[model samples]
Target: MNPARRTTITSAAVLAVTGGLLTTTAAPASAATTCTSPVFKRQFFANTTFSGTPKKTDCDTTIDQNWGTSAPTSGLPSNNFGVRWSVTRDFGSGGPFSLAVSGLDGIRVYVDGVRKIDLWKNTSTTVSKTVNVTIPSGSHALRVDYVNWTGSAKVKFAYTPRTSATVDTVKPLVPTGTSVSYDAATGKAKLTWSKNKEMDLAGYRVYRRLKGTSFGSTPLTTTTGTSYTDTPPPTGETYYYEIRAYDKADNVSGGTADQGVTTVDRTGPAAPTGLSAHGDLDGMVLGWDAVSGAVGYEVFEKDAATGSYTLLKSLTGTSYLHYVGHNETLHTYVVRSLDALGNPGPYSAPVTSDGIDRTAPPAPFDLAVSTDSGDVRVNWKTPEEHTRDELDNYGRFTVYRSVGSTLGADAERLDCDYSTTLDSANDVYSFGCVDPTWAYATTYTYAVTFTDWQGNESAPSETVTVTTADGLPPAPVTGLTATPRADGVLLRWNASTDADIDHYWAARGVRQADGSFKATDPCTRSTTDPLTALCIGIPDGETAAYAVYAVDKWGNASEWTIVDATELTITPGEPIGADSGALWGGGGWTMPGQGGNVQWHCEGAVCADVTEYRVSRWNTETQTYDLLGTVAPKDGVYYQSYTDATMPLGSISYYRVVGVLSDGTETVAAHPWQIRPDLV
Candidate 1:
C-alpha cells in the first residue's frame, strides 16, 4: 500500500464501538467497547460502507472493528452505521460552519433523517464530502451509512463554524455643512465648509467643479481641518464644491451636498471719463474722473495714427502730466484698473482727444533776405496760421537769427498783428525786420513762432534760409596730401576761412577702383575757430580723397575740395647670368618678367633679378628647382655685369637683394637669382 494515500476516520465510529449501534443493537460486547484510535472526528457518521468486501487496504487496515467487517464477505453489500440517537441539539449562533465525512469508499451523513452530506459512490480509494449547515445553538441528531465491496470500509467526518463579527462594516463620513458669501467690494464669492466626522477620519477631501464641468473627484486634502475658504472664483463662472471624509482605515464617505457659487466679473474700476488733455510748449496735461474701487490706474497713451499704446503712468490719483516735448496733433488715451491683489482689470474704452490750444500766431512760412549797408534785411510774412483757430489776443510772433554757426542769444518779437480774414476762414498776419548784427559772406537760419497767453508756444514754422551781405567766401580747399610715414599717409592742409565762417569741417572718403568714393561724414573739426585743422595717419590706398568744408552757424556748408591719392611700389630692374665665359662667351642670361617672388633663396645657375616674385620655387635635391626664381626684374636691362660679376666659376651661387623706394617703402628683391657655374 502506498504511504501517500490519505484516510481519515471519524470519532462517530469509536462512539458506535463504545456504545453498540443504537439502530441495530446486535453487536458483541467487545464491539461495544470504545476503540482507541489516533483519528479525531469533528462529527458523527453512521450506516457507511466500502466498495469491496471487508479486506486489508492501505486506508482501512486500522479501522475500528465497528466500521469494518471482521471477515471477508462474498459480494460487497451495503451496511448501516449510526450514533447514539439524540434529537435535541444545537450548533452555536453566527456561524459559517460545515460538516464533512470521509474514509469508506463511499459514505453519507444525516441529521434527524435529513441528508446533510453525500459521498456515496465507490469510485476512488478515499473520498470525502462536506456541506454548510447552521444549527440553532443546541444539539441535533446525526446519522451516516457505509458499504463495502472490493476495498476496505472506513468512515470519517468533521465540522467547523464561523462568525460575522469579524467582517468589516464601517463607512466614510460626510461633510456637515457649507457656507457661501460675497465680497461686495471685490465682487468675488467666498465659500467655507464644515469638518467631517469619523473615528479614523484621516482628513476631509474637497473637490471643486466649475459649472457645466464634470466633477473632479481627486481629493484635495487629507488633513483633519474642517474649515476651507475659496475666493475670487473665475469671472462669470459658477463653481461647485463637494467634500468627503476619509478614514485612516481606507474607508471613504459619500460626498456632501454641493455648494454652488458664482462670481461677478463686471465689477471693475470705472472707465476714466471726462478726460481733458491740455497742451503747452513743454508738454501735455491729462485729467480724468477717478474710478471707484481702483487702488491705482494705469494710463496708456499713443500717437493718434499707427502708434502702439505706451504705458504713460500708473497713478494712485486721477491726474497725470505729460511733456509733449514735440508737437503732436492728436493723441489716444486708455485706462485700466488695478486691484490690491495686483490683478489688473480689463482696459477702459479709448479716448481720442485733439491737443488743446489750437491758436497759432501767423508767422512767415518762407523767409527772404536783402542786403544794404553791410546789414542783413530779413523779411517774411507773419507765420501763416497753420491751425484752424484764431490766435489768442495775447498771441505774438518772434524772429530769431544765427550767422555762420553762431546762434544769436536774443530774439526780436515782431508786432505782426496785421490781421486779414481770408476766404478760407483763416486769419493771416505779416511782418518784416532788419538785423544789423548780421555779417557778410555768412548764411543764416531764421525761425518764427507764436506765443499764447499761457506761455504755450506753437512749433516753429519750417526753417527758412537767408544769406547775410554778399561776397561769400570761396569753398574750403580739400583733397590735401601729406608724405607717407610708416605704412600710413600723413595729411595736412590749410583750413578754409570765410568772413562769417563759424568752423571748418574735414571728411575722408575712401575711393574704390570704380571711381566711386565712400564719403564719410565730417570726421572731426573745430567749430569755435576754423583757421587750422590737421588729419593724420590716413591709411595707404589708391584714389583715396578727403573733403574739407566751411560751415555757417545756420548749417550752410561750402562746396567740397577733392583730390586723388597715390600708392607706392618696389621693383628690381632686371636679372643677369654669372660671368663664367661659357654659353654666351661669358654667361647665360634670361628674364622671368611675369613671375613674382621666389619661395626659397635661389642656388646654382637658375638665378635672376626678381622684382617681387611669386613664391613657386622647387627643391632640386628632391628632383625640383633647389630654388626656382620665378620673376626677375632687370637691374637697368643693361647693367648686368654688376650682378653677374659676383658669381663664382664652376660653382652655383644664390643672390637676393633688398629693394627700397624713395618713400622708404621696402620689399625683398623679387626672386632670388640662382647661378650654375656650369651654365655661366
Candidate 2:
C-alpha cells in the first residue's frame, strides 16, 4: 500500500465528479458568510457489505485527513474493509457548496440522501472524486462512504462554499436578554445581549432608530463582541436599538427585542464673572474669575458700530493677552465660558480700554476739480478700504478753496458733507462735492482732506484750479403749446428771456392720475432749434403729455412748461375690413405660443383718417376687448398684417381692430368670426 495515496485529493480531483452518478457545484461567499467545517460521525465496517460495523466509531471535525495503507482496526481485516462518514451542518442561506472525496477505492458522497459523487471500484492506485452540490438554507446532512477490497485503503472528504444557491431552511438561533445603559451627559448608550450558541455563529448586526421610527434596513455596525456603544442621537430623542445574529453561511436570526435609551444635554458653564480691564503699558489686560464647569474661556473683541464681536482667543487660564501694537488704540472686549461639550455661556459685561485715538488718515488721492458755467465741482478717489479710526470708525471728507494750489492759513473751507456714510454713486468710495454758488468767469483752486471722528485730519490732497463760466440759468420759456397731429404732438414754445439762453430740454410722458405724469422716451428732440420739440405718438392709441425746459449756456435748466395731451386730442375712425387666420396649418388659427397671423384692410376714408390700427381679443368671460398689440396703420386700402403669439390654445375669442385719431379717440373696426385655436 502506498502511504502517499492519500494525496490523491488534489485540487483538480476535489472538483471532478468520480462518476456520472453525481453533479458538482459550489456556492460563493456572501456579505455575511465564511468557510466553516462541522463535526462528522464515522462508523468503521468489518466488510464492504457484511452489514455490521464490528470496529471503531468516532466523531471528527472533517473527513479531509485520510489514512493510507492503514488497517481499519486492530481486530478487523485491513482489506475488504470500509468506513462511512456522515455529518449535518447548518447553512445560513440557500446556496451551492463543493463536495469532494479522495480514496484508494470505492468512495461515495451524498447530500440529503442525494448522491453527488461516486467512485465505486477497485483501483491499483488512489483516485479522487469531486462534485458540486446545492442545499437549501438551514440544516442539511452530508455523508461520505468508503470501501476497500484492494491493496490500498484511504479516504478523505471535505466541502467548500460556492456562488450558487441552495435551500437553507434553518435560521440562526436568536440572541436574547438584551438591555441598554445610557449616559445622558455623553449622549451615548451601551447595548448588551446574550451571545448566540450556534456552531456557525459569525457575529451580530446592530440597528438603531428613534423610539417611534422604523428600523433601517442596513445594520449600524457588525461586531463579534457581545456588547456595543452608540452616541449622538438627535439630542433629545429617545432611540430604540435591536440586534440580529448571523451564521457563517449568512443565516440571520430574527431581530432581538428593541431597547430604548434617551439622550440629554449637559448644561453649559455659567458666564465668566468679575470681568475687569485695565491699561498695561501701551496695551490692555483683561481679568475674569473662574467659572464652574468651564473647560475654557473665550475672549471677544468689539470691532464695529453694529456691536458685532469677533472671538479673539480661547484660554485655559482667567486672563486675556491683548495687543495694542497691532493698530490698536482703543477697544472693547467681553469674556464667556465654554463647557466640555463646547456650549458657550452668555457673555460678561463689556469693558473699554483707556486710550484716545490721534492717528491721522492718509491723504485722499486722484483729486479732480472742474468748472462748468457758474459752478465748481471737486471729486476724488479714496482708499479702496477705509482704515479704522482710533475708535474704529471711518471719517468723511472736506473741501478747501484757495488762491493757489498750495493751501494758506487763510484758505476758505467749503461746506461739504462731513460724514463718511456711503454715497449712492460712490462705487469705489470716491467723494464728490459741488460748489454751485461759485461765480462764472472767476477762477479758484480747490483741495480736499479727510477728517476723523476724533478730529484728526489727513494731509491736503492734490489741488486743482478751475475757471467757472459766464452766467446763471436762463428764464423759463413761456407760451408753450402742443398741437395734436396725425403723427405726433407738435410742441412750440417762446424763446427764453436770457440772451445767453441755450436750447430747451423736451420730454414726453404718459398721463397719470392726480394730474401727474409717467414720463416716457417716445418724444424725439428737435435738432433744428430749442423753440420746438416733437412728442412722438404710438400706434397703440396711447396719448402722451409734453413739457419743455429752458436751458442756459451754463447748463442751468428752468422749470418745465407742461401741457397735457388731452389739450390737443384726436379721434380716429373705425377700420373697414378686419380678419384673423392661422398662419401655419392654414386655417390661420394657431394655439397660443404657436404662430398665428392677422390681416385687415384700411378701407374707405378711414384709410387716411386713421392714425393707427390696434388688434384686440374680445374676452369671452368679461365681454371686453383686450388690446393685443399695434399694427402698421398706413394711408392705403391694402391689407395690414399683425401676429397673435399669445392666443389661447383651446379658447374661443373674437378679434377686431380700431383706428386711432390725433385726439386720442378710437373707432372700432368690423368684428371678425369667432375662432378657436388648438394644438390637437
Candidate 3:
C-alpha cells in the first residue's frame, strides 16, 4: 500500500458546522484548532445488528430514493439472486467513517451512482462490506447489491463517522493551561493538556514524536483528563508533544503544532546521611540513608593515600558493598543524590576509616632478664608499629611460662608494672615481678609482652632463670630423648639429681623445618617415681624431639634439657629367596629415626630396600674372607631377614653388614650372623 498521505484536513464548511472558532485555554492562540463535531453521533459499526447485507428502510435514511431492484434473468434461478438496502443520514468527507451493508453471496456498493467498492462473489462468502470511502461535499446516492446461488439472502447496513486525523497542523484543541515538566533523576516527563473546548468534546488524544520527526497521527491518550505523565524516559533526550480534541462522534480536530521541549531536571535528590564503611574479608561495605524521592544513590570511593575517587557503584538501594580487594590499601567513601528523573546531585561530605587488622602480631623477640632474687624482671621489643597510635598506650601485657617448649596448662596475667616509654626511647619495654616461690637452683623459661588495640603485640621477651629452690633438680635433666615405638614415639629423659626433686617432667614436640616446634600438649606430666618418663602417644612418621625439666609442688621449674634422639639401631633378619615364595617380612626400619613409626612406607606395598650380602670363610690356622654378591634395595622386603647362599661349603663363614638410609645415612656393622654350608 502507498505510504498513507500525511494530510491536514481543515475546512470552513466543517468549522461552520461547529458554529464558532475554538481556542486553547493555556497555549498560545496560534496553537489551537477551530473545528468540532456533535456529541451524540451514532457509530454504525459499533452496532452489532448491522451486517454486510442490503436491508430496506432501516434506521435513519440519508438517501431520498428507494433502493433500486435487480432485474432477474430467465435462465438464472431465483435462489441465485440476493439484495440488501439500508440508509444513513450522517455522512461526510475526511473520515474513518462506518458504512454497514446487508446482502448474501455477492454484494456491491455505489455512492451517487458511482461504483465505490466491489465485494460481490457467487460463493458462500459474506456479502456485507464496510468501506472507508471519501465523499464529496454534498448528499449523494448510496446503493448495494446482494446475490446468492443456493442459500438464504439478507441485507443490513449503517453508517457512523469516525474521528478525522489530527497531526502536523494548527494546534489541536488541548486542555487549557497545559504545561510540561520533567524529573531529572527518574527521567520522567509530565504533560498537562487543556480540557475540552466544546461541551460536546468527549476527551483529548495526546500525541508525541521525537524531535525533528513528523507528528504521529495515533494519540497516546483517550482519557478526559487534563494532565498526563511519561515515566522513565531515556536519559539526555528531547520529546515533542501535541494534543487533539475529539467529539463524541469520534471526529478529532487537527493536532496542535509540535511543542518542542528539552527537559532540564532541576530538582536534586536529598543528601545521603549516616554514611558508614566497614571492612570485611571480601572488601568494604558502604551504607547510608536513602534520600527521599531519589531513584538511587551513586557511591564514590577514594584512595586514602592519593585522595583520588572513582565511581564505585550506582546502586538502586541505600546501601552498597564495595570490595577494595587488598587489605593493605586504605579507602574513603562518599555518596551522591539522584532525583526521580535520574539527575545526580552533589556528593555529600566523605567519611574516612581504616580497615581493622584481626591478625595477631609476630611472636615477642629478644627475651632477657634484668633482675634476680627479689624480683624476676623481663624485657622485650615489638615489631614496628603498623598503626599511628602511640606505643605507650598499648593494652596491658600478659606473660606465659612453661617447663619446656610445651607451655603450662594455664597462662598467668602478670601484674608486674611495665612502661612503654622504653619503646619511645629505644623500642624496648621491661616487666618485672617478684617470685619468692621459685625453688633455689631451679631454672625457668619465661615469655612476656603486651598487645595494642589493633592486636599488634610486642615480641616476646624470654629469659631462662635458675631458681633459688633448695637442692635444684640436676641441671634440669639435659639430653632428653624421643624414639619411635609401635605406632607412636616414646619420649625419654635423663635422670635428674635434685635431692628434693620428687619427679621429672618430659615434653615432646614435632620439629618443623622452620625450626619452630609445635608442642604435642601444653600440660607437663610427672615422670614415674624415681625413673625417667616415657611418652608413647606421639603420632607416627613425624620428626619429634624431647625436653626434660624438674618441677616441685611449689610451682617452681628447672631449666629445660632438650635432645634429638631420631636415630635407631637394629639387626637385619635373613632375606628369603624371591623364588622361595616367601614374602619378605620386615621392610625398612619402621622407626627411621629415634622418633615416630612409619606405616606402609614401602614404595609399592611389596617392594623394600635391597642391599649387598657378604659371605666369609675361615681357615683353621688363619682367618680369611671372600666377597659375596650384592642386592638392590628394591629387590627385597624392607627390613626382613636375608640368608647368604654364596658361602663356601665345609668352611666356617661369617658376614658383615652395611646399610644406607633414603637420605644416604650409612651404617656399617656385622649383621645376619655367620653361616656355613655344613651347618646350613
Candidate 4:
C-alpha cells in the first residue's frame, strides 16, 4: 500500500452545495483549510456514499493514499469510508492531458463532472486505468473519488498537461493590466502588471523603444516576477514600454498596449563652434556660429596666457564686445551654450585677443628745469618699464612751454622730439631737453607729455617754473690774498655778492721776465666754491701770480681780481746747497714703473740734511710742473729714485728735484734735469 500524501493547508471559507442553494460552513475540527491552485481540497465521509457534512477536511498536493484495514482517520472506519479531492485552475490555451488512477476499492476521475478514468469496484487487488482527454482554454475543475468496503484501502490519481512542443502548439495569453511609473531622481522606469493566468507560463518579457520607433525584436529583459525596473537614457526624451508572456514550450504571446514615460531633461546643448576674436580701438570683439537648441551663451575670459577661466558674461546674442580699458594686455577667452534649464555645454576652443591700448605710459615724473644764458633745460625721469615691450607705447615727448606763471593748452609744443637713456643704476629712464628760445630776466612755465606713434598723448607731468638770469655779470671777488705753504700757495677771497653767480675762476702761473705771466692755467680748486682755492706743488725759486673772477649764470664775467696787487711772487721752498751732489744714472736703471724711469745718486754729508725729496715732471702743454711724488730718504742709501709710469712713450720731459730739511725748510735745485724716454 502507498503512503498517504499530505500538503500544507491555508485558511479559507468552505462552501456547501445543497438542493442548488449554496451554504458556507466549517467542520467541527477547528477551521476550514484553503489550498492554492494545483493543490486539492480533500474531504472524508464515514459512509461509502459522499453525503452529509464531511467528517474531515484538509488540503492534498497528490491524490495517493492507503489505509490497510484500519480507520482512515480518528473518526472514520477505513473499510467503509470515502474520500474526494478537487481543484480548479487556469490551463491557458488548454490542450491534451492524461488522467490515471489505481485503487483496491472503487475510484473515478472526472473533468468538470465528465468521467475520464474509472475503476469502480471493491477488488481485493489494485486496479488501474488511464484516459486521454482534451480540455478547452480558461478556468476548469477536476475531481477524484474513492471508496473502500473491506480489507486494504488504497487510491492514487494524477492529471498532467501534454507538454511536448509538437503536441502543445498554443501560446500563453497576453499579460494584462500593464502599467509603468518613472522615478526621475534615479532615472529609472518601473513597469508593473497583473500576474498572467497561464498554468504553463515561464516568465514575462519587457520591451522598450523610443517614441515614434517600433519595439526591437529582442526584449530588454525577462523577469519571472510581474514587475521590472528599467533605466532609460535620461536624455529628456519620451520612451515606451510593453509587457509580453512566454510559455515553457517557447511560445510567446503578443505584447500589451505600450506605456510611455518622459525622462528628466539632464542633457545640455552642443558646444559652440567657429569662435573668433579680433581687436578694435576700444575693446575686443568676439563672434561665433549659432548653436542648435541653445537659448543663450556664456563667455569666459582670462587675463593671461595661463590660469583658470572665469565667467565674463552671459547673453542671448552670438556676439559680444569686451571692453578693455587703458592697457595693451592679452586676454584669452572661451564660449559655451546653455539650454532653457541653464545646463552648460562643452566649452569652445580657447581664443586669444589682440586688443588696442588707449592708455599712454605714465607721465614723466620728477621734472626739473634750469635756465642758463636764456636757455631753458628740462630734465625728468620715468618708470623703467616704460622703455620695454608694450609699455613703451610712446615714440617721443611733447614739450609744452608757457610765457606766464601757469602752463595751459595754449602753450607751445616744442618743434623737436626727444629720446631717453636708461639709467640702469637708478632703475629709471632719464630724459633731458633744451629750450633755447626764452628771453633773459623773464619767468616761464614748462611741462612735458609723452606721445605715441598714433599721436595719443599722456597726461602732462608736473609743471616747473623758472626765472631767467639777469643779463649782468657779478662784482669782482674781494679781499683776495695769496700765502705760500709747504704744499702750495693758498689763495683766499670773499664770496661773490651776486645771487645768480654760477662759479668763480682762479688762474695762476710763473711770472715771465717781462713782468708778464706765461701760460696761465686754471688752478686746482673747487669750482663750486667761490671763496677759496689752492695752487699745489709750485716749483721752488719760481715767481708766480694769481688772479680770480666771478662768473654769472648768463656767462658774463667780472674783471680779474689780481692777488697781492697782481704781482705776488710764490717762493714755496729755499734753494738746495750747491754741494748737494745729486746726479742721475745714464741708462738701464730698473725703475719702479714703465714709461719714464729716473734714478739719482748723491754723496757727501750734504745728503744728511735731506728729510725727503720732491720729484716733479714738466707738462709742455700747460707750461706747469706736475708734482710726481714726495719720498722720504732711506738712511745710508747711495741713490734716490722716482718713476713716472703714466708718462707717454716717445716724449722728451724735464723733471726737477727739491729737498726738505729736517727743520721743515723746503730747498730748491739750482739746476733742472731733462729725460727723453724715447732715447732710452
Best by TM-score: 4
lDDT comparing candidate 4 with the true structure:
0.71
- Of the two candidates 3 and 4, the one with more favorable lDDT, higher being better, is 4
Q: What is the per-residue lDDT of model 4 for residues 348-400, given as tens digits with 9 covering 90 to 100? A: 98888657644455688899998755667888877774354323543677789
Better of 1 and 4 by TM-score: 4
Leading candidate by lDDT: 4
Compared with the true structure, the alpha-carbon lDDT of candidate 1 equals 0.48
Give per-model TM-scores: 0.22, 0.30, 0.23, 0.36
> Residue 196 of candidate 1: its Cα lDDT?
43
Query: Candidate 4: misplaced stretches above 4 Å?
Result: 1-36, 267-680
Please write out the lDDT profile of model 2 over residues 268-356, one tens digit for every residue: 77777888776432346678999876878899999758799998999888987576643445688999988767888899988886544
Q: Candidate 2 versus the native: TM-score?
A: 0.30
lDDT (0-100) at residue 55 of candidate 3?
21
TM-score attained by model 3: 0.23
Compose the digit string of candidate 1's lDDT tens values, residues 357-424.
Answer: 54433344655555554555555454233332334445555666655444456644433333333433
